[model samples]
Target: MKIEHPAPMQWQFSRRAEQLQSSVIREILKVTMRPEITSFAGGLPSPATFPVERMREAFDAVLSRQGSVALQYGPSDGYAPLREWVADHLSTDGVRILPEQVLMTSGSQQALDLLAKVLIDQGSKVLVETPSYLGALQAFSVYEPEFVSVPTDDGGLLPETVAPIAQGARLLYALPNFQNPTGRTLSVERRLALVETCARLGLPLIEDDPYGALSYRGEPLPKMLGMNPHGVIYMGSFSKVLTPGIRLGYVVAPVPLVRKLEQAKQAADLHTSQLTQMVVHEVVKDGFLTQHIPTIRALYADRCQVMLSAMDEFFPKSATWTRPEGGMFIWVTLPKHIDSMKLLEEAIAQHVAFVPGTSFYANVPETNTLRLSFVTVPPERIRDGVEKLGRLIAAKA
Candidate 1:
């Protein structure tokens, strides 16, 4: 067989695509899919919560009733009924949004991608919650924005730190409730302060709330969108409550931004899946989410207590971890001498693994930190995993 010679024509590509790298966690998951690895590394939810049998019903119904539309290409705007459903549900947050404002994304992660496409240009300034969602970081990175982190305390983001920085920033990506990594909810005081500060500065805010409904403790604080709807782009997902495999998520951006986001969506693969939208719509219409979410909360609450108790029993005094009220993750800060990336190698060697904190930061990672998730494993594995992690720390000490 003879190979065809290349057409030696000069070609160029978007500077952004040339700089991008595939997700690290996605690659790691392929290895962890093996039965032997007790992976604490993944952000996966518990399989017990995935309504596989119900999904089979959804698939059958969609095919039997709405086969062509379900399988064929959809409008760039997304399925209308599902958009209306999301808009109606969002009304509970005191947000007055129409179905037109909602863009169905493959997941909230893709919503981040669309926003980055619309908002970020080279050297554009982006600010994030310190140790914010790593997927958000990866999505925003393709545009090569200059990222700056704001310090957060137990109650979440410190507004005094953020007020001055909002000065000429293009975007503020906030995971205010039950934030990933830390699992801390922004206090009502900080939320209000953040809202006021950002709105005053005319900065575009991206409010990512994939973990809001999963809270097991504390009173719900008013959403940032409620405080100032005009300036915030709110991102939400069914990945936690319903199922992630469906890839259903949406973003409610403020008016002007919403228009551009739709154009960006057109370029980024047309739209989110129509069949998945119909399935989610069917389940949501049946009131399963309202009933299903509380069970998830209960299971996670019980698991959180078990993990916290295990942390108290096993973790060394030199190490400290966040006690998150609601959310899937807990961040741990190890002793200064411990580089989490180095320690992850040790952890994986013991048949246990976790994401190193280095990957989460936009600038330099606080090498002593790492995130541990409590929702994926059964409580017994969390206990055993924490014990193993503890033993490794002791050995290193």
Candidate 2:
């Protein structure tokens, strides 16, 4: 006798699941995987800069010297020596950081998610730059907070304008050094004022500085965390300098907040990979990045110049773009009549690609803006891709 089977149950998802959306940059990267496309859509560091030989040596050393410890389960907070290194690395003459305040994350991206889980609630007000980092917006969206866009210019976020709208905000997130989408750096004067303003108002500030060390001039800027360590939460990463495959990044915060984040992280992933942490500590323990980072600065600076020159020669007179002192991206603003989203379709057809500015916004988006990454592409290819994009914009303008 044949038995009748019941229909499969429809899955019920939480309200948080409803807020999920795929990353537009990651989606565009799929199309650019073809060898014929000269793509500037991903924020990937140049593979030429990765320390492959050093990493292989470090992995071999870790497994040979301390195989059991390297492979065993470690503390939820992180490896001890790595935490101490992060503390000492970030400490300055004006401010001191303790090892107890550091928490290791899978990457800085995971740190963003941990912060959202610890700080955000339904309808909590969060402030961000007018066109903020897309990853941050995506991470915070899952927690269901209301985002308010703060006005900005080439100099970066306006300090005076922050106080008026910051009344009920939970936190003010800013990338004061070589921001992600715009590559704009906040001036030292503005940094002081913004930190003082937040400190006076009793509001917390989140300082994300993944690109701070990439300055072309080799001059480092003062971080806001040094100004008010108790009030600001600082996030840093090794992805830009080392390789991203190891997936190592860190957070330095007040000890109390660090403990809270550690608890949240435990509930999420229990702990980061033990073997990866040991290998990274082994690689960076002896001042490897001191010599390595300058080479990256020089290479990126050269590529940036090549792309800028190509844009000047090829783009229409109505088009304008930022001349970044450092970092991988240059933000472009086309004529008001042109929409970069539509322009991207025409561009991909011509074997060139870029990220549209719409995904970078928290609320309202500027359709005429787009971001171009120059580090992964060679200098000659940079010129060709920029020229192709320029022709597309000129036709629309």
Candidate 3:
């Protein structure tokens, strides 16, 4: 122990690992964990949403029936039956996909990681929404790509605005339905335009949709993959509908890219958990999702209504936020000179927590912006939480 190598062996480390950005949600979670605090910070599904009781039953059944397979190392591509189940569940209208197209992941987060590994080189140009998923930004940042933010509005990303920017980008990443942080969904017409434009520009699209199944308003829009299978990597997750604790998600990409992602997954994590896949396959086998998902949607819809009502009643006239139809988060922008990060200390003193919005951006950040999550808390607490945030703002004024 006393003997040390000359110069301490120079302390080897990868340059890529140094550039990774920590998630703002995590920091906010720490602040919210105090017993006095009410968290509107994490993009979490409600504990009420987790079908934990049934999943215990499902897990037991899976373990009993396929004990060896459940515990053993498995193929990187994913469990065949689980892939088949996902493809079948995604099938709608006249569109369909085969199981061969699916690649299971630890979570959709892993899909973002694999995409970054396969597609990005240092200094590659990447396009993202002005207010994007912080997790996606963090995952992709490790590769050290130059990023550009495309402007967005309540209608979601402006297709025309991004088309010009797409001219030089290697990949265009978006969370089209109930987008994280902003809570804006793209119009169907705009979604088609995005697919077509990206195809024309040769910029592969990573269409991240963890919230699509949770949408509580309007008829479902056809997915980008359903429209143009060859051009988009459509990522899906069970975390929103089932339970996030299981960490099951998947991606469907074109054959060539799917192979590359599979290899990358093997290199990165060997494979996603087979036990979880077996559990998921067992749960989905008997049409449990048909009964399960609607419960999540209805509960979230009621929570969303509670948030809107609370915002209307309590927020300052100078503050404005999105009126989202579905999903966990709502984006808020304060009057100029108000910094959400700075306000967070006072907000925590008031026992309410929300994420500062700068964390979502690829470049320049808006000091006025913030993100709030309504999915995890009770409807009454959402009312109380937003009211407290309003009081916090008024005190600053």
Candidate 4:
């Protein structure tokens, strides 16, 4: 048999393909993978916190007890026992969540993608927080939604910001607890006001809470989903608490919306991996997270303090940053004369790297801002990295 070779033809791409943009943070993270770099670029959880032994045991137990089910395909809605566990875990005093409302996803990233697939359309208005999660922006942008970023403070998005933008918006996406890029948590008072305002405005809220479990104080605030169950769509993940390798995340929304998301998910990847789902359920169903999570909290808290102290001692007076109670990151604002992207080049040359905040903006980016993740770097290295970054900033200033 002879195979004939044909001339290469020009490929035409869709408008959506033209709209697709690369993740700037991820691009920088690739450069930081070198062993010599002390990186604060990626929002990576500490490897020391993974429950390796427990996961191994869970894998063994699942293989021994229900090998066939573990390896077989699962419902797009998710594993029943896992869904029940999610509902029970997130259900609070007055807010009742049912297992049917929970849909398991490959990760929170997939949840964002699925939500965008179902909820977003061409030229749809999507509200986002100023300096929001870059991944969310990337996921939503592919659908060609007009992103409007609401102004934020240390307490997160202001309620007043929602009123003007809420009229024709499809959804308001926010990270209320230890927000990514900027480690600001939404205040309890602000949460109440924002939820009330959105409810009154008839705007849907997409609350992404991947880092809620990592709070150092272990004091959880009122969730928007709990406040206005009908209006808020909640997303949660085990990536931070357990491990990212399993790639498990879940979403709790109104049933009708969940059904639509299920359909979208079915087309995407059929369902999340059954083996990982069963293994995770086996690991957490035993109440292991109760004791295990506190250890992670303590470790992260210590690391956060180290980074803060280092910043205080080494950074210039013109350089300001957030003091977070929990989560993996700290947001910094350098002098107006300095650009974070330029600083990153110099920092990487000095064996240090961080993500510039330009990528997080949906519009009108502030170039002087940057994000530094503290959880993965050790105290001594964090001190050195901060010092090097500070020196670079001072020189630029």
lDDT by residue (171-258, candidate 3, tens digit) is 9999898899898989899999999888888789889999887778634567888888878889999998888999999999888888
Q: Write the per-residue lDDT of candidate 2 for residues 1-397, one digit (tens) a residue.
A: 8759978989898878977999999999999999999999999999999999999999999999999999999899999999999999999998889999999999999999999999999899999998899999999999999999999998889999999999989999999987889989999999999999999998889999989999999997899999999999999999999988889999999999999999999999999989999999999999999999999999999999999999999999999888888888899888888899999999999999999999999999999999999999999999999898888888888
Q: What lDDT is reached at residue 298 by model 2? A: 96
- Minimum summed lDDT over a 10-residue window in model 4 is located at 1-10
Clash pairs (backbone) in predicted model 1: none
Which prediction has more favorable lDDT, 1 or 2? 2
TM value for model 4:
0.98
All candidates' lDDT scores? 0.83, 0.94, 0.87, 0.92
Where model 2 places Cα greater than 4 Å from the true spot, the runs are 1-6
lDDT of 4 by residue, 1-397 (tens): 8758977888899988987878888788899999999999989889999999999999999999999999999889999999999999988889889999999999999999999999999999999999899999999999999999899987789988789777799999999999998999999888889899988988889999999888889986778889988999999999999999889999999999999999999999999999999999999997999999999999999999999998999899998999998888999998898988888888898999999999999999999999999889889999999899888888877
